[model samples]
Target chain A: MTSPTPAILPERGLADRLTALFWRHPRLLLAVLLTPPLLWLGVVYLGSLFALLLQSFYSIDEFSGVVKEEFTLKTYAELFRAQNLDIIIRTLVMSAAVTIGCALIAFPIAYYAARFARGKWKAVFYLGVMLPLWSSYLVKVYAWKLILAKEGIITWAAEGVGLSMILNAILAIPGIGGNSLSTSPLGTFIVFVYVWLPYMILPMQAALERVPTSMLEASADLGASRAQTFRTVILPLAMPGVIAGSIFTFSLTMGDYIIPQIVGTSARFIGLAVYQLQGTAGNIPLAAAFAVVPIVIMLIYLTIAKRKGAFDAL
Target chain B: MTAAVEFLRVSRHFGPASAPVKAVDGVDLTIAEGSFFAMLGPSGSGKTTCLRLISGFEKPTSGTIRIFGQDVGDIPPNRRNVNTVFQDYALFPHMNVRDNVGYGLMVKGVDRRTRDARAEEMLALVKLEGYGDRKPAQLSGGQRQRVALARALVNEPKVLLLDEPLGALDLKLREAMQDELKALQSRLGITFVFVTHDQGEALSMADSLAVFNEGRIAQIGTPAEVYARPRTRFVADFVGSSNVLPPEVTRAFGGPMKWASLRPEMLRVTAADGVALAGTVTGIRYLGAGSRLSVALNGTEVAALLPAGQPVPEPGATVGLAFDPAALHVMEGEG
Candidate 1:
């Protein structure tokens, strides 16, 4: 047998050689394919993070009103003060509350979508969940402001239905309560829940979709009640999706400033504090340290969630 | 003896009244206690619906269903003493084999120690003793099937419903599982109501099988009775591969019925006459078990299953195909 030249082979080109090379050395090709994105991540994302960390270590010269590039915990010490501590704790509490609330609300909507809603009704339910997300986030936030105002339809309906006393009682509670639904932390929370709800519902539906109908039947066939089936079979399988959604609701609520700035009254949230410190006050070291709070909290969250296999579904 | 499960004119329909799909149309059946019963049918033939009705996953549209001679009309599935092994194996993906197996016990509020011990026993019963800690995803198709069986069997219900549990496995695994299931059912003395579209599996494993066709029972008899003297053309064709002689051939055979059904193996091909019929070989199909020769005669064609070792006759080869005069089973409709 004679060795055939590229011309003699009838199908010869650079593309052919590259294809052959790729087929022979897939790992090398994979590395080559991935390098561009990895380089982009390394330089653009991780590099900026590294720069931010370096800035946190550097301190500002108090007397000269200039940032001095030196390693210090003075900014962190400032961050742990009573006022800063209150903001951090408040943000944590609200995020946790919003996450729990989203879970409680999203589960039924997601369950209805995954299990019962079929054909045209399923499309409608799906559209209802996602339609709010398609509109402008700010528009939705401002819309909530009008809906929750003192003389808004909510208060009017509550009053009209003779539930004004109950609504007032709920609003009169210490931290969360306010004069009206709007112009309060309650308003901010409602808006945050409204905006980030689809994030929770979508992952939950996707997760529930992976659960087989036969498993439910099998559970019933095995003498498990409807409640038992939900607890034993359905809930555990759908946990990763819930956690994936909680990551969105929790992190988004923790880092939000616009909702608070618009609706809240004199409340200094973490995001608002971070914005004021970095953009207005021009305290790079302190602001960098302040910004690290959410990053640190999210890091801890992701690490624990990863350990629980939350990222498996995500 | 009291029936293990009984359905009286059970019917389940779907869609609008104008054009409803009668998934299980007015079928009556009684599953004997401690017998291996199979509901065999093609897809959409309501064998699955029969199994589901037995399991209480679905309620009958109008008819009454009984279990152990008790009217279980209002009883939910959890209230009924029955368990099912789903076709897809339906083992919980999140739970280990032990947890999945022990779930029924756990649901009954049995203590953890007892559940674990029983789960261990069930695992051993299925020959998966050391695989308790493995998730359903980690197991192979055959292993998953056994796990599903073990899980359902762990409950030790009066009746066990299997919806083609071995269908997902390959041929060898399926055959092995079939024997294993038959042995297990006999050993345990539980009423096994298995459903499958595979006629061979039904014929081999079932002590008494119900042949279902289009939301109705075509025939309910022992495998031999159904295979030998099927009452309907559908049953004759479905029980095993049969050569259905057309009306012309039936007329030739001196039958009054519209069609005559005979097993391919019953027909003998020969080079000499003095047999039942003469035909020309038109096609030869080499099945691994045996060769099938397609013979054509007088605008009618029939296939004969010949012995495996013989040289198949060439196309247009003149041959005689013979069968016993009484071997032909005549059918009334759809010749």
Candidate 2:
């Protein structure tokens, strides 16, 4: 028996035509999909960073003190001046201190939440960590300023508890201590740690959660002490999370000028100096050069962290 | 010798008091020293949970557990003289295999030289001599299993616990591992307590096996003994393939109780020999080694394993099946 030939439809739907084109050229389709976001990130965000870096290389005019369009290392050379170097060091030290403090405090909290804490308690802990973040950052910084004031609740409580002497003793230290914690480098460090702590805790909790209960049991079964198991099994495994959290603490502390402005005494941090240079002094090249310090430091830090396998956990 | 591990009415309950999930309920077991013991069950039968209890990972809701006559009820898992090979291997992903294997030694403050030597020795023992420098992610699934075994065995604990260590491997690789584990256990002269849902693995590898059924041990005996005689209905069905005769079928020939079980291999079939129980072959399955004939007998069906090269009968052909009196395993009690 002869079968009748069927006629093919000539007109193609838009979706069908696009699908056919995509099917025929998958890589082109992928490029089409990814182009917009990649274009946005590459041009808008990274383009400014690249431009800022280029601006750092321009020379500062000797007489006019204005940024010269000519490229030179004069501004970069000024970065090594003693006072500028001192501010860089101060910022570095503070960033390290805040990162360490955040890690120390965040780890125990994350450990408890991930391994042992139950339903309602886990939610409570999560809310406690996250709830503070919903408030304005400036508000929290100001609150810390009030809390650390000479006539603040902390000093009053310290005095009431006969701990004022201890507080004064702590305030007498050379670099970190000052008249009052509100007017101290120590207070800035504390505020930085407080602000970035949630960033530390969440990553730590996630990393700890990925650690199988079986491995912990395995460690125990192998005749290791509780401390030994934690040292050998838990801590080494949690390093990635610590490194990830350090990224937050370190970068946040390094870049923030606001906390130092409200809470610090006489010390100038990298961010504050950079702000003064760019805004008040109109030394864009020098400010950009100073800004390159944190960027360079973070690049080095991320490299070291990557070597230590931090991104693997992420 | 005294048992290496003992569970005295152990039970672990989770969730609210009103309706707790009984992961392990009043389990009393004695594991012999230097023997390969298996806790066999289907998923959620509490075998792994029982292993956890023995390893001190979980506290029993009631009862007590002892290791080498010492009560370990209050001991944390790290203090226990037992090592576990986790199902997922649980090798430290951050550490090289040498470090992973030697972790317990390092924890004990063993010097680096001694730890390295022992880890090296363990690597060689698992046939992964050069794999010591590699990471867990760098190794294949089977190689990772070996690394886990080496890690647990390196500690030389009183007993080693393996939680479905072979569950992740392919069938061919799993078979090879089962033999390796048996050999390793015997050579090391260490008590091994492993859990698995695979009946064939349990039967082949266990010196003594316990069948777990819904948080309780259904039966415990040697592989041969359990297979020859399963004491409960659950065991008769779950331990291996068996034709569980219905009450009507048993009563048709006045054989036994409301529930009786017969191993498929134990039954013999004949086309026209006019055996006591007569039936028609409803279905025929041609397995490589032998064939399984599904017979429709008096309101019930039973399976009989026919040897290869037999004169096969077509479907719907009349047939007769017979078995020895001892083949009728009376499945009694609530399993």
lDDT values of the candidates?
0.87, 0.88
TM-score of 2: 0.92
lDDT of 2 by residue, A1-314 (tens): 65575466554789888887888998988899899999999999899888889999997787988778888888898989998888998889999999999999999999999999899999999999999999999999999999999999999999999999999999999888999999998888888889999999998998898898877777777777778778777887887888878988999899888898999885788888989999989889888998889999999998987886666534
Q: Tell me the lDDT of candidate 2.
A: 0.88
Clashing pairs in 2: A220-B78, A221-B82
lDDT score, candidate 1: 0.87
Model 2 CAPRI quality:
medium
Name the regions of candidate 2 deviating beyond 4 angstroms. Answer: A1-13, A16-20, A117-125, A159-162, A306-314, B272-275, B280-282, B311-317
Best by lDDT: 2
